[model samples]
Structures are given as C-alpha cells and as structure tokens.
Target: MARRGKKAKGRPISGWVILDKPKGMGSTDCVSKLKWLYFAQKCGHAGTLDPLATGLLPIAFGDATKTVPYVMDGRKTYRFTVRWGVQTTTDDTEGEAVGTSDLRPNADEIRDLLPNYTGEIEQVPPSFSAIKIGGERAYDLARSGEAPEIESRIVTVHSLGLVEMPDADSAVFEAECGKGTYVRAIARDLGRDLGCFGHITELRRTTVGAFTEEDMVPLDELIDVADENREELDEEAIESGAKARILDFGPLDEYIIAPEAALSELYEVMLNDDQAGRVLAGNSVLLRGRDAPAFCDEAFATGHGRLIALGAIDQGSFHPKRVFGGKG
Candidate 1:
C-alpha cells in the first residue's frame, strides 16, 4: 500500500494581529510572514499598504477573517510628507523624477490650501495604482508606458492638516480619510495645486478603524522570539512560545484579538442557548432585549462574548449571514 501524506500543521488560530509594518515590505508579504510565524490556518489584512509605506497593518486570522470587510470599510488615518518642486512617475521618491520646479509653497500657503482638500472631493487616483482598468491593474499599464485612463471618483477626506513645514521644499501632513482615499494622489494633486510638481517622500498609516499604531507589533520583535524558540519540538510549540512573549504586552490574548473585537463598532446581541444553537445551525431566530430591532443590519450575534454569527435583523429576527469557525 502507498504511504499516506503527513497531516497539515498549524493551529486554527482566530483573531486580529495589528502589525507595525516596516518600510520595503509589501502588505501581502507581511500577511504571509505573520501567518507562518503564528502558524495560523487562515490570514488576511484589513488594507494593502504600499511597500514604500510603513505602520499599522491589521492582520486577521481564521474566523477573524470574516470581519476583514468591516475594518476595510472603516476610517483610515495617514501621515505623509510631500516633497515640493519635484514629481515622479510613481508619484513617490522611489520612482524616477519626471518633473521639478524651484517654486515652494510657504506655511501660510499650505495652510490655506488644506481647506480645499478637506471634506468630500473628487480625486483621480495615481496611474501607478492597484486600481483596475479592464482586467489588469492600472499600475501594470503605467509600467508599460501605457496611459491608463483613470476617472475621478468622490473620496472623503474627513480632515487634513498641515503637520509641519519640515523644510523649504517639503511639508508634512496628517489626514483622516475614508476607504479608497490615496495619499499618493493627494500629494500629486497638491503639487499641481501649489503650482509646483510634488511627490510623496514618506508615508505611514497611523490608524485603520478601531486599530491604531498603539496596537501594532513590529515584525522583527515577533520573529526574534520565534527564532529563539526554534529548538521547540514542533510548529505548535514554537508558535505558542512566541505568542507567550508577545502576550506580555497585553494588547492581545495570544497575538490575536478576541474574534468579536473585529466587529467592535457593530451592535452586539448576546444570544441565549437556544438562540445560539439556532444561529450556529445557520437559521434565523427572534432576538430578545430592548435594543433588538426590526433591521439591525450592522449587528453581530454573540454568545458569552464569542462571535456566533454576523448578520442582520429583518422582521424582528436575527439571521446568520456569516457564521464563525465553529460553524457559528
């Protein structure tokens, strides 16, 4: 008889891991690296950060992956530096410089320009972006010297402030924006608006939804702990030990958030044993309590603080749209 293959490794770990990503690491790579270090069965990130950018990258594991959409749709905050008088093909320092000017905007000029960018505004994404044109990414088109016809879309910039006039040729800014907003585009447009070519010199994401820099762990720190435990008997042993070191920080139970924490902004309805059973079965049931509504679309059904199902209320009923890993 032929020998059977070995069983798959890694734990069915569930929850969020906020990583303070460093520059030069792509978001997809960061997710993959963290997935291996944690030995999680599943992994995903809230948003994609450019390889040239750094900071808060919320990574979800196993059941927490179900809540990725909620975090992805939430507010985002960024800190970026705009280098005036020079523009590049990629609209960032890494790209070849395509244009330059001697004119630089003064502090007062930048401050005056901030109001124009705040609130709702029309923005054309940078050509060198992940946005799709036909079946291909726009950046891929730009890379081939093909101009991707990108249209303007309304994106909300909740707030924009001039953080500092760091030098005669650059200005630092902090922006609170909604999903789909591009800081690179902002720098490019700001340069044009200021009568000088502009490009991003540095960029960092400070927050995404309820997660922030305060909740992030540097990848190197986590990797070092795992490296020290390499002599452990198995993958689980090393993963457990690495988590133990990280858990001392208290932001996570074991390098993972409580699964329910992913949907913290949504209203929660704790179900009774019978109701929990119904939800786990992928069935709808009436919710008990004064806050229960006819249509609580943005709600989560929980049992003893554990996520049972995420769904909506219709006709005064709780429905299980997306059940957790335990089939609930």
Candidate 2:
C-alpha cells in the first residue's frame, strides 16, 4: 500500500468508505488496511464487527471520523446462520465447543419463536467482546480466567424474518435491530429456550444505518481498485471517491455530497453566516429561521437542537462545527 506523503503533494482525501469486510479479519485491521490504501492520516470504523462476522463496515477517513458516532447510532440489519445442538465458549464458531445437545427445534417451532425476539428484548453481550469491565476489556478479563459479571442491556429488534431453514439443526435469519443488539446472544438464548444450546455458525451485517452491503466494496476488491484519478484529493475528491466507490462507482464531481450530507437526516435550522460561525464556535444558537416541518421544536427544546449539525450557507462562507472535516 502506498503511503500518503507528509508534505501535501496532492490534496488530502477525506470521506466515508463502505467496506464489505471479509471474515477472519478484525475491524481494526480493516481500518488499518484502508488507511494505508488511501494514504489517510486518520481513519476509524463506525462500529466494531467480530472477526467471525463479515459484512458492511463503514470506514471513516480524514474528517469523516468525526461523524462516525452519528453513523454508529443508526440501525443495523444482519443475515446470520445459526447451528443448533452445540454451544461454543465465545457464542460463535470461533470459540471452543463447550456443550452439545441432540434435540433440535423444527422450522415451525423456530418460526413461532422468532416473534418472541421481535421488537424490544434484553440481551447480554458476548464475554469475548470489547466491552470494558473495571478498566480492562471484557475479553481480556475473560481470557485472564476471571468471571466478569456482565449486565444485560435492553436492545430493540425491529424485525426478524426467517430467511431459510435448511434443516432442523440449522437456520438462517434476517434481522433488523437497533444498536447494541447482540445476535450471538439471541442465538444463545433461543437455543436455551428450545432445550438445545446453539451458537452463531455464520454472520454478516447486511446494513448499518443508511449504508448497506450493496454499497460495500469487498476488502480484497478495495485493495485491488486503483486510486488513479489523483487530481486534488481534498474534501471534494474524498467525497467523490466515496460516492463513486460505494454508491455509483462512476466519475463524480468533487462536491458530490457536501459535509452537510452526513447530517441531512437531523433537524436543521439554516443560519446566517454569522450564526453559523457562532454555532461552529460551540455556542447554542436559537432556531429563528423559517419553520421546517421536519424540524421538531420539542426536540430542539430538549437539546435536540444541540444534536443539530451545521453547514455553510454557500460556497466560501464558513459554518461552525463542520462535523465531517475539521476533526479528522
């Protein structure tokens, strides 16, 4: 991978990269690969995916890292296949087999059980996870032979549909879930309820917020793809490159999507250049602009306005908190 030179020989590249992460690679490893591939100074992933899990992992390069949190909050959809009658130490196939059961639930029985997991449910994260416990990673503690008590958290499963039931011993499911929903936990709990222990045999993230697997580039393909159109790789090139790579894979204008594109879903109040400056300076600006039906006053009243992000009124005019670029 070619490294970006310290001196700005070309423009700096910055934007999101939708990576179709391959299994057996950690999220951090994927980010590092992209960082090297693009010659980016700063790069981070919106969310972590276990090495056993593969699918869409959004990589934020340059300024896009600042908006990673916003993207992380978005809902995720996954397609996972679970094998019944066996339980692994880590809940997924990556771990040692800890237990087994002979009995397996039928497809009809599984469909009946799926509804119970739909909507809101309580889940405990896997022990072999990045969760911090007493200032140490939970996985580290677990690996150190410590029994760390993990608290169960409430997570939402918006929808769960059975995609395929090949046999009584295995099933494939498509699930739309809110942030923090652990699919491994669901598999474990489901197996427990069915009188058979189970673990995730395979998992792939289908969607994360607005990004989807269809929008993702395979990690190998990304490595193979050449960054040849190396004009000025500034914000414009970065944005254009991301759109081209993820959305269209065609030539795009430097400004295909503005910095504000990251925050278009949030309620916004257009500010004058001066107000924009103040907002950028970290001051809370009142909503005085024309009322947008999309803008909720109650939400704004309760610091939802603070949740709002800023953008320039026009070209050359500056807005405070250009959330996409400045921080990275």
Candidate 3:
C-alpha cells in the first residue's frame, strides 16, 4: 500500500491571540470560536480552564502553537472568590453541594490561614477534573458514579493573599503559582483549615506566563469583526453577531501578536546569514559576538525580520533545538 500525505486547508494564520474568556465557555470551545473567526488552519490554547472559570486564555494559531508549551510552563496569577459554608463535588460552584456548615472566619483568621497555602504544599485535585485515571478522564468517572481516589501531589504557590471579603459568605483571593497548582483545590483546603466548608464561587485568571489581562480580547468583538467583513469574507463570513460598533477596517490586525512575543523573557539573538543557514540545516554554529551568551538553554533566532528557530547555546556555540520555519 502506498501512503499519502494529508492535505491541510483554511487560512495559513500564524500568531498569538490572548482571549478574555467569558464564564461558561470551555477553553477548547473558546479556541474553536477564535479559530473559526480567523479561519486558521491550526489553533490551540496554552492551558485548560474549567467552564465555571473565566479570564486570560491564550490562544495560539498556526506556528504560534509551537510555543504553547513554553507559556503553559510559565507562572500564573489568579483572583478567585471562595464561598464559605459550602463544599461541592467539583470544588467549584458548578458542582453539587456535598457538604455545608454555618462556620465563617473573619479577616484576621483568613489572613493567618493565607500563609499556610503560600509555599510548597501537598495538594489533592478535585474528583471531578480532567486528570486521567487509567485511560478515562477523572470527571467522566465521577459522572458515571465511580469514586476515584486522587492522591495528593506537591505543587508550589509562589504567593497567596486574601484580597477581600466580598460578603459574609464569600472571601476573595489572589494567588500567583507555578504549573499544576489548582485554585479550586485551594478553596477546598482553605475551608478545611478555617472550620467551614468552601468552594470556588468565582474565579478569574489575571495572568498566564507572559500574557496578561491587557492582551485579552472579548469573543464578541472578534466575532463582530468577521460579521462586519462579511462582504469580503463571502460565504465563509461569520454572521454570529447581529450587534457591534462597525469599523471600515478589518480589526484582526489590531488583535494578532507576533509569535516571537511569546519568548519575551528569552533573549533574542539575531543570527547572521551563515549561522541562520547552518542552524536551519541542523548544524551547530559558534558564537563570538558581545551579545553571545554566558550560556543559555535557548534563545529565539531571527533573520531577515522573521523568527528563524529556537537555538540552544552552550560554551559559546549555538544549536537549533526547535525550528520555527516551514510550518506550512
């Protein structure tokens, strides 16, 4: 049998899109919406956010998707509301109430408890979650009436603070954490420490890696653009929106961020023609310039105003670890 290469269609879009995800929309659903509006050939989100959670969701299109792992590994900051006296199946408001209480802690007590969650700790994820048990999703097992014992794992919380007490029944929190740290689990544990059952009433991610609230765009606004450009988009035009402030120019240019922007923390070292050629051809090149590294694990390479590849520098030599070109 002769094997054949698969064909790809749709716009060859390549860039980063930060979406201010609205509540009730799954992260995948939000990415799908963005992909459809842009008509991109490929798209994916940096991280998964539960339907009950909202805020900064980074969506990468085409070549930008290659950098998603970098963003996912970066630190994240969140602002969440914990509703005391209620513990739920999922540890969030969307889940059914599993336990309740009349206990509520005051500001001094809450502040005292904040330090307990601020450093390295063993945290157990909620039963209703995306974690895999055997081959099936943990959430699926929970929905099917199975009690899957989720073991505790070590997670780092860079910082955790009590933002405010919105009401007698709720307390707001701000947490900046490393990868795999769940805000929902924090609420669950806090209630246990404060003598009141707790669950996340509301949650918003303020930051994810290098992307922040300032970079996010609302879904309605993006959809509105596709609607306004219907005449040019032809039958492929998105008409999901019936309202918006119409503009003569297409709004997409204003929203797209350069794929290289994802490597803002990484020092970019523009390679010469020779170095670029050698790196692209899967060969190592020497670094002798003033900008040459003491030694870095990786640096974004650029040539002729284009992202070339992610180069690995060691002992003043550069090697191409991940190529960014020819993504089509």
Candidate 4:
C-alpha cells in the first residue's frame, strides 16, 4: 500500500498582523511566536527587521503571503540615530568597530550634506546584510571571513533630514525611502562624507507601504490576551458551564487585519457577480465601463467588497492571476 501524505497542521487562519516589533527580537522569531499563538497553518513577514531595530513589521498569514511582494515594494520611513565617532562592520551596533574619528558634524554641517544623500543615490549595502552573494548570504560570508564584494546600486531616498543632535556623539535623522534602501548605509556614507566615521546606534522603522505606526499591535499585548482567555476557558470548563470553546480565538480575531488591506495601493476594478465568478475560476472578464483603465500592469478585482483576484488589465479586459477567497 502507498504511504499516506502528511496532514497539514494548525488552523487555516488568514489575515495581516502589524507587529510593533520590540528591540532584541529577530523578525523570524517574532513570526514563529505569532504562528504558535494564533495556531495559524502559515505565517510570514513582509519585511525583515534587525535584532537591534524596532517598529512596524507586517506579519502575513495564509493567502496573505501572496501579497508580500507588494508590501516590500512600498515606501519605507525610518528614524535612526548615527553615532558619529565609530564605523562598525555591520553598520549598526551589533558589529565590531572597524573605523573611528574625532570629528563631529554640527547641525548646519549635517543639514548641508543631506541633499547629496537624498533623491537617487548610489549606495554600497553593509557587508553584514541579507543580500545574497554566490548563492550564500552576505552576512554569512562576512562572518566566515570571505569578505564578499558587494556592488553599489541606485536607491531612492525620497526625503532625508536631521531630526536633532542629541549630543556631540550622535545625531538623529528621519528618512522616507523606496525599497532596498538601507538606513545603515545612510549613516555610513554620511559619516564618510562629513569626515566623522559613523554607524547606526539606533534604528526604528515607522512605516511600510499602507501599514503605519497606528496599525501596530505589540507582541506582549497579544500574549496577554491569549493567556487570559485560556485561563478563563479552563475555569469555565471546570465549572461545567463552558460558554465558549477554548479554540474560538475569542478577542484575538479583532487584531487580524483583512488580507485585502495590503493591496490598497493597487488599481481596483469592481467586478459583477458573473465577472467575479469567472475571475475566481481562473478566467478573464471584459471591463465594460468607460471608467475602466485602458491598460494597467497590475490591478485587483473585488465583488461586493470581497477580494476576488489580482492581475493585469489589457485592452479593457481584466485577467485573473491570483484568485482569493471571494467566490461564494
């Protein structure tokens, strides 16, 4: 007889969770904890936050993972502090100091230099980064002493300004940049230009795509609710008056943002019932309205406020690429 296939585990929960990641927790570890807490069958993060960094980390469960690329492509906002006297291997506090300087830049001097780093600029990512080289992670290569050569790439920095100079040793700055822009590289390059070798002492991501500071739910808050609800369930069971099932999610469902929220930036095409059915069946439907886009590289269709598919519009026809839970 043929061996049976392995059964899938956990609940088929699907949605987005904007985690206000605390310092000292890796992004992967945070996702793992969330998976266990929610008992979700699948979980993934939209962006990676360093162990030393903190702020908005969008966690995706189930089908929401299909939209991760869109979130990653969105603009990112960060407020980081640069320690002006040292340059570290990792470009942040976690690495050894490889260079030092006594010269510290004043506010006026830093202000004058901001324009050069803003808009489009060429940057060499920190050696200790997630960038892959030769099918191996750059950080791993750096740790193994392979000293990988990373090429400089063009990245957009929409805005960059000095927020304040906390002391002679550090300067706080805020920036809004496009994908692939590294905050560490900003500090490193700025320090080199100012003649005051620097590295990021503090880093915090304030926004990514449609997700913002206001959307974040801290890890501890979720844990607290999970524990409290479980205790209540146990007590009710002992009393033989169980009003709710232990696995019912209780108040935890409130934190799950709908998966369609991640696709807000994409062009929206409203589909009729027939269109929605066709789209859900992996078929294309003719867009009948004059308001319909002539052509679009990417667009999402929704029927009665429910996400149906993600695809492109060409010649007044909407093609379905990725179908979702919109078919009734």
Candidate 5:
C-alpha cells in the first residue's frame, strides 16, 4: 500500500486582510507575518509595494487568493512626495543619487505639466523595480552591477494633480491610475520634464481595487487582539503546553473581510441550492430569471450569500472556472 502524505498545517480560513503596511517592511514579509498570525493554509497579495513605501496592502487568505488578479486589475490611488533636485537609480529615496539639478518649478508650472501625463502614456520602469528581464528580476540584475535595459510600456493615469508644495525642494501629488501604472515613474518624469531631476521621498498607497485606507488594520492592533485572547484558553491546555499548539482563529476572524468583497466589480449571480451544488462540483448552471445576464466574460456565483465559484457566463449558462469550498 502507498504511504499517505502529510497534511498541511493551520486552519483553512479565507478572507481579505487590508493591511496598513508599515514603512521598512517588504510586501512579502507582511504576508508571511499575517499568515503565521492567522495560521491560514494559503495567502497572497494583490500587488507589490516597495519596502520604503507604506499604506494599503490587500492580502488574501485561502479562497480569497483566487481573486487576487481581479483586485490587481482595479484602479489604485497614491499620494507621494517628490524631492526635486536629485534623481536616483530606484526613483525613490532607497536608491543612490545618480544625478542632480538646481532648478525648481513653482505651483503653476507643476500643475501645467499634469495634463501631459494624464491618460495613456509610455513609461519605462525604474531599474530597481521588480520587472523581470532574461528570467531575472531587474532589481536583482541592477544590484549585481548589470545594467538591464527595461522596455517602455503604455499605462493609463486616470488623473494626476499637485496636492501641495511643502517647500522648494519637495512637492506632494496625488494620482489615480489603472493597473501596471508606476507612481515612481511619474515622479521621475515630472522632475525631468521640469528640468529639476526628482525622486520619490515618500509614497503611500491609499486605495487598491475595492480596498481603501479605511479598511486597513495595523499590525500592532492585530497583535494586541490576539495576545488579549490568550487568557481565554483553558488552564489545562496551558499547563500541558497545548495552548501554544491550539490555533483558534476566532479572535482574528473579526478583522478579516469576506472574500467576496474583493470580487465586487464582477457581475454576481445568485444561485439556488441545486445551482450552487453544480457550480461547486465544477459544472455549469443555466442562468434563469429576468435579471439573468445574457453574457458576461467574468462573473461570480453566490449561494445563500456565500461565494460558490468564480466563472464566466456564455449562452445563458455560467461555467465555473474556479470552484471554491464551503456551503456558499
């Protein structure tokens, strides 16, 4: 007889954790810490934020991981401050100064340049970015003393405006843009256009997809909540040292937003018991009723207010692309 494989540890919890990522921590590190805290079976992030940047980082656990692509495809809003006079290799303060300038543009001058950057435009990502070239990350190659040529691609900027000018050396701006848009590149290009040569001094992402700063939970707060619940464990378990072994997600579950929250943009179809069963089994269910959509390239099915599957609608039938667990 064949030997059975070991089962994965942790609870199979599923939800979204909108983290207020602290500065000096990488996105991957944030995910790891949250996973360990929640003791979740699976976890992922919708987008990458540099270690120096802070604010909203949408993390997905278990079934929510299936919707990461949708969250990443949503628009993002960022507020950043640019130091006008020096350009860096990374286009952020984390990099070394590659060039300098003495010129500074006033408020009106900066506002005048905003329109040119709005709408679709070509942008070359920073050399120290995560973009891959020849199967290696651009940043990795740059750190190895190799100058990797990064190609320019078109990205959409929904709106760009000057928020304020704190001083002659720095200007604050807010931008709402589509997926793949680089805020660092915006600051770099703005400086170059103004002949001031700039780099991002501070960056904060306020929104990503349906997640906003309001949804963010600080790490300290989560830690405090978990620590406070330790007293609830039984004395017997504590004496046996099984208290540490027990992974009760009840305390932390309140902070986790429902997984369907990430899929708000997709068309949702309410399914009956039979329909949901078929969807859960990786099959198609005919969309009926007056409100039924004729066709949708991407949509989700929910049964009894719980997510059943992420799929597509064609010819009046919803085909399950990814089936999810749970009664919903």
Candidate 6:
C-alpha cells in the first residue's frame, strides 16, 4: 500500500495576542502586522485604541475571538496629562489650536474639583471621532470642513484623581471608567469648568479589562527578538533552518488568561457531560438541581442552543452561555 500523507499534522495554533501598541500607528495597522507575523487564518481586536494613545491592546485569534466581547465590556483605566490655556479641534496635542485662555486654576483647586467628575455623569464626545452620524463617520465629515452636530452620551466615571500638577498650566490625572468614556472630553470639560479653555497634551491608556501596561511588550523589542531568532536559524546550517527554527515558535498564551479566568467575576454554573453535549449541540438548558436562574424561557426561540461555552460542575445542570473551539 502507498504511504499516507502523515495524517496532515495538527491544527493551527490559536489564541490571543496582547500588543503594547506604539503611538502614531492605528489599531488596524497593529492587527495587520501581527497577522503577517503569525500567519494566522483569522484575527480581530476587542476594541480600537486611538493612534495618539499607547497601552494595552487585546488582539484575539482563533476561538479566543468568541470571548472578546466579554473582555471588552470590562472597565478601563487611563493616565493622561492635560494642558490648560489652549483648546484644540481634535482635543489632543495633535489637533490645531482653536482657542486660548488666560485663566489657570491652582493645583489644590483642581484636586478639590476632581471629585465632582467622579461617579456617573453625562459627557459629549469630541467632534473629530469615530462616532457615526446618519451612517457617515464623524471624522470623515469633520475633515471636509463640515461640523456635524454630535450628541452627548451618558457614561460612568468610576473614579478620578489628580496625579501631579507640574505647573500652573498643566496637570496629570488618572481616570477609571466604563466603556465609551473619552478622556479628551473630560479634559475639555475640566478646562471649561475651571474658567479656562483646555485640551489634552498627552494621553496613555494604562489598563483595559484585566490587561495592564506592565504586561505590554514594546514594538521595537519584539522586532529585535524576531531578528535575533532569525540569526540563530542561519547559524544552524540546516537546509530548511529558517522554517524549522520558526516552527519552534511558541503560542502567545502569555497574553491570554484562561477563558474561564476572564469570567471568574460572573456567576458560574457547572454542567454535566450530558448537559455539555446538549449545549454543544445547540440546546437551551433548564439548569435543574442547582440555584441557576430559570433558563428555560430564555432558551433560544427556535429551540436551538445559544450558549457559547460550558464549565465544570460538581452537581446539577448549568447551561452554556458560550463555547470555545480549539480551532475557532
């Protein structure tokens, strides 16, 4: 008999890659670079970070993409520097200066006033943003010299604190907030609140979901590592040395916490093998023998399962809300 083709090997590696995005590059550019590096079949980002900002950016590959929305819904933290006395069209250092002010509030005054912004409050997004109006991107309209009316959105600011007051005209602060919150708007509003126009001079996202700046690997460092690995293969002197050497490249699991780890904060329900199978087969579970919320009514209207994954349980049934496939 002829030899078989060695069973076609194993499946492609899949997981998340958290990049420490460099300033001046858009989020899409980061994804494109990673796709080439890994030769992945599919990839996507959980959220978009501004080109002017730098920090933790979660890029999901394979089945991990299914868990992205849960991760993106988590809270975010940022540290930004605001410069008083000038306002800008885009609200950041990159924008053209549009207005000026002479008043400058003292550090103590700003610290005391910071409390008013904490907790739940409504905020308006900057004009030059990604928000859509009448199905057109706001920034596209803005670049055409047309000012479209933007609406205010209600967002929660979990906490706000002054980090430093470098001078009478500039201050640094930290903000913890929910999704969709804009630091530029906060800076702009802070200036107006204090009787002076203001705009952000610097902004950096320190944290997104569970990932933080500490977990980030600089782009230059990554590029250097890649170059070093390539050199090592050349020295090996094998016919396919480069390809063989790169094959030893490990999975990017350092950036991905366990799938369940991402949902540890949520109420958990374990399912038996039968329940797990049913969930995987697309069926809503009644979740009997446990205190799980009544899920029968919430099951899919078509009777097909909508759960994504199932978890371990000592006893009783818990429906799967999400599923993870090794090759997803």
lDDT (CA) per prediction: 0.85, 0.70, 0.85, 0.90, 0.90, 0.71
Candidate 4: lDDT over CA atoms?
0.90
Model 6, 273-314: lDDT tens digits are 665567666554555654555433222111122224644322
**After superposition, which runs of candidate 1 have C-alpha atoms over 4 Å from their true positions?**
1-9, 232-253
lDDT head-to-head 1 vs 2, winner: 1
Q: Each candidate's TM vs. the true structure?
A: 0.89, 0.75, 0.91, 0.91, 0.93, 0.79
Query: lDDT tens string, model 4, 74-187?
Result: 999999999999998999988998999899899999999999998999999999999999899999999999889999999999999889898999999999999999999999
Q: Which digits, one per residue and each the tens of the lDDT, describe model 2 over residues 1-328?
A: 9997766432255667788889899999998887766656677898899998999888876656666766788889999999999998789987888889999888888888888898888888889878888898989988888877889989999998888888888999889999888889888888889888999999999888767665677776654453444334468768766433233223322221232334545544555665545665656554442443423422111122232344333222223344322432
**lDDT tens per residue, model 3, 1-328:** 9998887766776788899899999998998888777777899999898998889999998888888988999999999999999999989977898899998999999999888898899999889888898998889999999999888999999999998987899999899999999899999999989999899989999898999899988888887776876554334344754433233334775688888878888878787888888777888788877867868987878765667788778888777788876542
lDDT by residue (18-122, candidate 5, tens digit) is 999999999999999899888778889999999999999999998899889989999999999999999998999888998998899999999998999999999
- Model 1 residue 306 CA deviation (Å) reads 1.7
CA shift of 269, model 4, Å: 1.8
* Superior candidate under lDDT, 1 versus 6: 1
Model 5: how far residue 59 lies from native, Å:
0.7
Candidate 5 TM-score, true structure as reference: 0.93
lDDT of 3 at 165: 89
What shift in Å separates residue 114 of candidate 6 from its native position after superposition? 1.8
> What TM-score does model 1 achieve against the real structure?
0.89
TM-score order of candidates, top first: 5, 4, 3, 1, 6, 2
Candidate 2: clashing pairs of residues: 280-320, 280-321
